[model samples]
Target: MSKEKALAIFTAVPRTHNCAQAVAAGFAREALVDTLHDCGGGRAPEGLCGALHAALLMAPEDRREELRKRFAAGAGSVYCRTLKQELKFPCAECVRLGAALAEEFADKPEIR
Candidate 1:
């Protein structure tokens, strides 16, 4: 995942992509994006987080949990609304974190 690209997508005007969509799309492109949207529900509350989880569903349980923990540690919450309202976490930062984490785990043998 390209952090720059994910950030761009998350911060884009009109904001078509959410944090999950940006990160998933950055790493796996259309396939992941489509899977996320289909599985996670497009633009629903916490949809991005759901998409992230869905994207990594096939990975080992520990790896999936680690990714979730990483996201929570960085964004304060995986949910967009909570991150924004309670933690004041910026969408751009979430996108960056998501992208960076995805990149870190993308090549892992157990991530598929």
Candidate 2:
């Protein structure tokens, strides 16, 4: 999918539960969207607030793993890692949603 669309999906992830990690995962767009929907759209029966938060700030691709590893090594939970330790979340949701926005669009011609 295009970068804008990918970002739209990622940005929308936190509106639900707050797991930004999904946005940075190496998974497919559809899967990530579905996961976000489940968590944000009042469909996450189990719920994953922290994961949703981290995914929002994640890179548009698989690079989020690096953040995940960092989180794992630095903090015990994803929320604590990014919010308390890294202090990356500069938004009300505890994460800087779309921090990698430029990188996700880099190297690619503008869509449309």
Candidate 3:
């Protein structure tokens, strides 16, 4: 899926996609989307932000921590509650950034 289409899915009205769904859908990971259904709203394992969890799921195993670090550097935390309540970062924007950062893994593209 194209980047525009991915972002559109995340921003769709009536909001079907959760943070993980939105991020996974961005990279055409339809299967991941289903598995992540219950992972949003701070429910991800270890309290991970759903969007970051989905992005890490797509990267190489050895690179997951790196991706987490990179994501945290941008968002100030990898957990949903921190981002939502403490940092005041928005979920929609988290999905957008998570998908964009994950794209860098697939295409080796520089951060946009």
**Best model number under TM-score:** 3
How accurate locally is residue 9 in candidate 2, as Cα lDDT from 0 to 100?
Answer: 41
RMSD of each: 4.1, 9.0, 3.1
Model 2, 20-81: lDDT tens per residue? 33343323444454445434322233332344333433343545555445434433334443
Model 1 accuracy (lDDT, Cα)? 0.63
Find the number of clashing residue pairs for candidate 3: 0
User: Higher-TM-score candidate among 1 and 2?
Assistant: 1
Q: Model 1 reaches what TM-score against the true structure? A: 0.69
Ten-residue region with minimum lDDT total, candidate 3: 103-112
**lDDT tens readout by residue for model 3, 1-112:** 4455567888899889888888888778899999999988999999999988888898877677778999999999999999999999998878877887788776673344
RMSD of 2: 9.0
- lDDT against true structure, model 3: 0.85
Quote the positional error of residue 84 for candidate 2 in Å: 10
Task: Please report how far candidate 2 places residue 3 from its true position, in Å.
Answer: 12
- For each candidate, the alpha-carbon lDDT, in order, equals 0.63, 0.38, 0.85
Evaluated against the true structure, the overall lDDT of model 2 is 0.38
Model 1: residues with Cα > 4 Å off, grouped in runs: 38-62, 108-112
